[model samples]
Target: MRRLPIRPFAVLATVGTLVLTGCGTETGDPGDRPSSAGADRTIRAHKVMQLTQTHEETGMTLLEGPVFDEDGRLLVVDVTAPEGKPKVMRVNVSDKTFRAVRTQGQAAYTSAQFSPYDGRLYLTDFAHGEIVSLAPDGSDPRTFFSGEIDGARMNPDDLAFDRKGNLYVSDSRGLREGEARGRVVRIGRDGRTVTVLAKNLAAPNGISFDEDYQGLWFSELTENRVSYLRLDGEGRVTSSHTAIRVDGGIAQTDSIAVDANGNLYQGLHGRPAMAVFNRNGERLATVELRGRTEGLESATNVAITPGGTKAYMTVSGPGGGFLYTFDALAKGIRQSNGG
Candidate 1:
């Protein structure tokens, strides 16, 4: 068995709050229905293509968190590298060219997102417990936030920002399970206040906001289940429910992404498959990975392009890590970068 650089047993500590903004806007309403529930509910499999062999070329494995940049380049983290080493790579989706996006020697980079407000990328450093900000071209790297929040150590993993600029992060706590150590936090746009939306999660690995921006969804990796939470006017979680529970098939789930139509995609780590869920949390389809190298052994993360035509996913195994691109049945929600 192969081990990823980021341990699955770590946890984080902290909670915060801030004044809610734009509560009644399109991105603020939590009343959107979850599923369209018609022909859109089922998605057929599409063509999957392996883009590059960077991991094999550089001996860098354990890839995670892929987000498309404004230029349509995908930025992913190579978590196996050490501190002070360059760990993020920008890949050109068209020509299959890639290069390291230089950062100021931050710790291991895990997940990254394009911030619409600053026109910058926010990345999660697994070793430093901080969020590092840098330009889309990977310049002017700086620590956006670090250290304890609300008196607890903040180990941010996968993160996403709401339209209002509030950041939500999953503190995997080394991917510990069922200990209540794992937590989800919302950071205010002001960059000071924090709010604990959900805690005691069993390895909350992947998180995303609904298309309506009214609800938040996350997957408990070890629990083999996905969950949904509705937020109140104050950005506090008002209600929660189990979205989907994988009773069989993939054992562990990692990162996830959602499309504009509320279709959810989750990477089934240790398996060559990705599961799709409708807005109502029903299992809609299962897209099995088909690659030249015996399929994707470990699908770590999934991201859809802004136009929603292609869905990019990261996979790793003993052989190496590879980026798999395929035509998506549904259109993904555009990120802050505009893809």
Candidate 2:
């Protein structure tokens, strides 16, 4: 991920206060009643793999983009790891073991997903402003999308693919309030033509196609909200609107996934939780960490298995990075794989 600029002094002061005093409280708009507000069902997630060293000595590690390959192996990215450290890892959930898959580059890979057309793994290299792809075994890395569009650089954060193999990316460039320089772009299946589907967004980060692929959903980090874009037969946006507004407290929204039933599992920072919402924006439930949140404040991304019976979340903070699992609310499909 691109380094975030420091906020204004007043906003920093307020965020500091919230961090100190609201550690145990649930975060959401008071006007919106979350199911967690009334004995809502809570899924306890346990750690499956540890991805980092102690932050005091090695700095913080950020884990994002939990995805599963056709072989059922889980893959994730370590965005904060420097050169020579593992940037991509493969984990076997059955035995709770993991191994470094690729570590030869200096790329800050923020998200990973398998292409339906090629079956290769594609990653969003946020630090390089490009999308790179490699074979399932982590070999033959090559640039898939790079350079600029309309004379502007792109900070590609996350991506999703359609049934026809077309790719959509979220260009999370501007982080400042009221700076709507962010956008969403699409790459045709031919791998040459690039189109800007939406622009003037506020740090559009997580992106995924909704059920039936008739629309798209993306999270605007700067605005702390999710927006939906109805797409035409040619994947052009016909209409768009804000679907959900989140009260992030001291944090912001991050990566997201969609279930077969069209429920959105949105990851959150500054807390170990995920807020679930139906396609219509109704609060369904808030999936919270099962244990201590002392150093696990960052729950940035989630991936559900094919059957949707189980889900995994990638979390990180000063305590390092970890993978947590919980029961999913609905059946999982291709859309729930990753973003």
Candidate 3:
């Protein structure tokens, strides 16, 4: 049940395809993008699954942080080269038409996620510092959370939603770049707030819930580790433990995601590609990746393609940001399906 991005208005009603982009790109194709000493075509790419040239930024980059709605439309909040309150745009996956999503938020948006349950969009304003929801028909905006919790600091950078409609936000807790104290707040319908479901954690960048709601998984950026906490009846932490620790020793792990089969995909902050971990916390795969060198170099956001097809990631750009798609199998990709 995917809805078109067009309202029943008199004009501008068009259809588009869903796309995923990332990487601070180099001015060449994947084959020309990067190569190791003996690396050649053996590092083949699967159909170049998808490509984005941010012409807006001199054809050297694609905006980072791409997400999708049900209609298969790709939405990304470009932090660089922002113009007049319009920072987010929808890129037609099948085609290459760009439409604006939000032009003004009074703050720079770090990341966002679409609510499939309601077709509403939620975004984090890292600069002005808040979480907001965009109107369904692309209308007004509303505030969900701000850096103020009971008059305390709660600046949010990332967001995640659970199966039952509970909202999870990754509150960096402070403004310092890599602060260790962070919290994941679950906002219940009753407006009640809950924490870490455990506490004294590291910089939890991305937060996700297991399909069964039995537990929650989150990753620490500076710590380069992912942890899982069994949730109690009220979504509080019952038992928490590390699911995967960056083996390369002290690499920064940014964004994280889980797939249909229950495997984890984690983006290493300083690595050339992303890493895969089994639900059992075993090392799985390292997704090969590279960009135009003109855009983003880091993959900070990750999503599982709808229908279990591809893996979507967002790499912030040199100026605009881009989204890149990967062939999970062809790339020797392993999903977080507990395998």
The 0-to-1 C-alpha lDDT of every candidate, in the order given, reads: 0.62, 0.74, 0.52
Scanning candidate 1 in windows of ten residues, the lowest lDDT window is 19-28
Assess every candidate by TM-score.
0.80, 0.87, 0.74
If candidate 3 were superposed on the true structure by all CA atoms, what would the RMSD be?
A: 10.2
Ranking 1 against 3 by TM-score, winner:
1
TM-score of 2: 0.87
Q: How much is 246 displaced in model 2, in angstroms?
A: 1.5
Candidate 3, run of 10 with poorest lDDT: 5-14
Cα lDDT over the full model 3:
0.52
Ranking by lDDT: 2, 1, 3
| Cα lDDT tens digits for candidate 1, 1-339 | 332332342422212111100000001111222244533232222323233332332233456778887777788776554334447788776676778786345365668888867778888866568888888888888788787865776667788888777788887663533465678888876677987888877877778888787878887777878888898666789899987886535356666788877777776665656666777766656555442444235666677778655677676654455666555546766432211
How far residue 309's Cα lies from its native spot in candidate 3, in Å, is 1.2
Model 2 misses residue 10 by how many Å?
A: 20
Clashes of 2: 0
User: Tens digits of per-residue lDDT for model 3 on 48-68?
Assistant: 233343433222332335566
**TM-score rank order:** 2, 1, 3
